[model samples]
Target: MAIDDSLATGQRSLGDPAHDYPLWPPLTSGCPRTSTEDVSYPVEVDYAYDKADPAALFSPVRARGGLERWAPLLPPLPAPGLGEGATPLVEIEPGVYVKDESRNPTWSHKDRLNRCTTSAAVGVGAPGIAVASSGNHGASAAAYAARAGLPCVVFTGPDTPPAVDAFLNAYGAVVLPVPWEARWPLLRLVVERLGLHPVSNLTTTHTGHAYGPEGYKTVAYEIFQDVGVPSAVFVPTGYGELLFGVWKGFEELRRLGLADRVPRVFACESAASGALHRAFAEGAPAAHVTVGASEAYSIASPVSGYRGVLAVRASGGRALLVDDRQLADAQGELARAGLWTELSAAAGLAGLRSLGGQAPEDGPVVCVSTSSGFKDKGMGTHRTAPATPTWEEVERRLRAAGIAG
Candidate 1:
């Protein structure tokens, strides 16, 4: 397929017998139809690296900045940015690293996604952007929309954390609290009637925005640059956009003769409602599971997408599920290690623990921590009592607490 020599040419579907389409606005919903019933899976940008300069394509300039660092592989970013990428890769333990995405401008990994999706809104000349989110996605989208000087509307659930709602409102986004089932329909209306660009799932199986995950690919690029290809990468998966993006980034690196081996990717999900795990177990293309109550609401997806399956299967990885108890333990462990993350964000570490003995012998495993602990709904649930400022009382309390040797 002929493509633009500089940047991207078009998009290609991940459906059976993949098809291609031109690069343009409203391109995601218009990707080549895959099923007889008119269902469309996700589409990825196609870059003509063969025609372009490979040396300049993977130049040192990529080591700086956010999504712009890898602009050659991303869509046209007409929107302003907030320095969303370049997160730290800290070694939490021996042979294990944590990609701390909480350092992003919005204090979550969703900023990377919004950078591209909001740009699509600008590229299409849309007046505003909309998303169906209660947490990171909503906050990140609102920030990016504000950065781009565009209006934003968020279809949030009733149980959304007050802090998240506050941040969204602070960004000047229209926060609409609706029923879970009604969010998508309302988002559709916001997109169709008001001509707003949507950055969330519009399809049945989560064919997310065409340009959104392309921004996620920068995570993989950053990881590869920081410490080379890891032995494995454990990711907290909801719709699996980040999982697929990281895999695609490494895949691109290998295709470009940069890396010889791609890390074994793992889709770490909530056991209470692991749709991807269920799908993998049942040998189905995609599957739906009745979501149960869980603290990891951000990663509890009722319906999963084929993009996740593609990432795991393509990268010789597996899908693992962890319960709330495990997630809590992992959260504590991360905090002990000086990295506080949201309950859902600790799923990667929980999944990594689940593979204790069976972990790859190559070592150097990387786990992606998605968000900050402040976003946790159960945060500050514990109470602390203040003591009087007296040396006698202090010594007694310290002795009782075993701190006064």
Candidate 2:
């Protein structure tokens, strides 16, 4: 149980049960990766990798109340749920399963990021929190900020999801509906002046702030516990944080000997943008392009991240671009599975289906469903019922609809 001798150096080791995870490459690269001025730029997060095994992450001596194993350098925040681990590893087929992240507190996996990002807000002593999102991340940040009693502000797009919008409002976040292009500058101004924390990725590149992915690593933790290691994981890629986080989690699990091997990290993106799709093939870190429109708006991004490339390469995975029609079909299949998720959420399922459903069974097939179907603001599915409600009238209606109760 000794620390990897090579990994040992000037680390403040807690032989009792704790350790810090570093974020930078070795200093011997002859590049002082971290400098205080980088606090202005912050190239390498002031963090380090730990010798702690993945299985020991929840041990009391190593954990904060046995929930989160504090990021060796990342800030602390509210731990959502009762450790938020043990989320349902639901079976979709004999071996395939969907990690229904929608069941999380805000009905999406963003809770994991929120838990970590909000912790950053607390750690940095931000007066408040802010984000440019009209979806799960916005609502999640608001709720987490409220839980932490930090003031929260959210810059939403005009087309922001109604369910998520209402959640932000309910949490009393200062919700500002701004145009998409205006978000980053506005966030910059706000952060410079008001000192509010920005949770979403400000970098046109998609590195999403440091702490958000820290929380998202929990998804991998849960998956490993459920099935040990899967043949592959299909993630609904948006900013690519969740994709990279899940990949990193699984990778860390393997490093810790908790899981046997790595799963194929599938980056499922909407065909509208295909940033990850193109970047992966080009063998580059990340790339930027113009975003085309699609029903999977959550993932319609022209830019991807460096971490995304690392995830795919490290796991021997592929980047998948799914069309809108295929996405619709995937949503239907999931509905049949009794999992009602949004079109973007179904993107992962679509990628799996495109794989011919012949995925191997190293453990379980996980499709990272990102959000609820209620997130589809353009959904006109809900309509007023027809007139009349008597037993005979309902019977006649059911007959016309080919339903019998």
- Name the best candidate (by TM-score): 1
Q: Candidate 2, residues 1-405: lDDT per residue as tens digits?
A: 111211223321111113333532211111123212211111212223455444445343322221254344233443333243345777888888898888777777888778766766765667888788868788888888888888887888988867667778999999999888898799878877987777766654655676566566778777776667888999988767788788877766676666678899999999999887887777656677688878788888867766677678888988898999999999999999999898989988899999897558455688888778878866655896786868998888888888975
lDDT of 2 at 68: 51
User: Candidate 2: which stretches are off by over 4 Å?
Assistant: 1-75, 78-85, 361-363, 379-381, 390-405
Estimated TM-score per prediction? Answer: 0.94, 0.82
The lDDT for every candidate, in the order shown, is 0.85, 0.70
Residue pairs in clash, model 2: 20-72, 21-48, 21-49, 22-47, 22-48, 22-49, 23-47, 38-42, 342-373
The per-prediction CA RMSD against the true structure, in angstroms, equals: 2.7, 6.5
Please give me the total number of clashing residue pairs in predicted model 2.
9
Which tens-of-lDDT digit does each residue in 1-405 have in candidate 1? 012222888778777535887777646452457732333477888877676555775665545456766677777777778888999999987788899999999999999988888878887889898899979999999999998899999999999988888888999999999989999999999889998899888877768888888888888888887888999999999989999999999998898888898999999999988988988998865777899999899999988888899999999999999999999999999999999899999999999999892346685889999999989986666587888899998998999999997
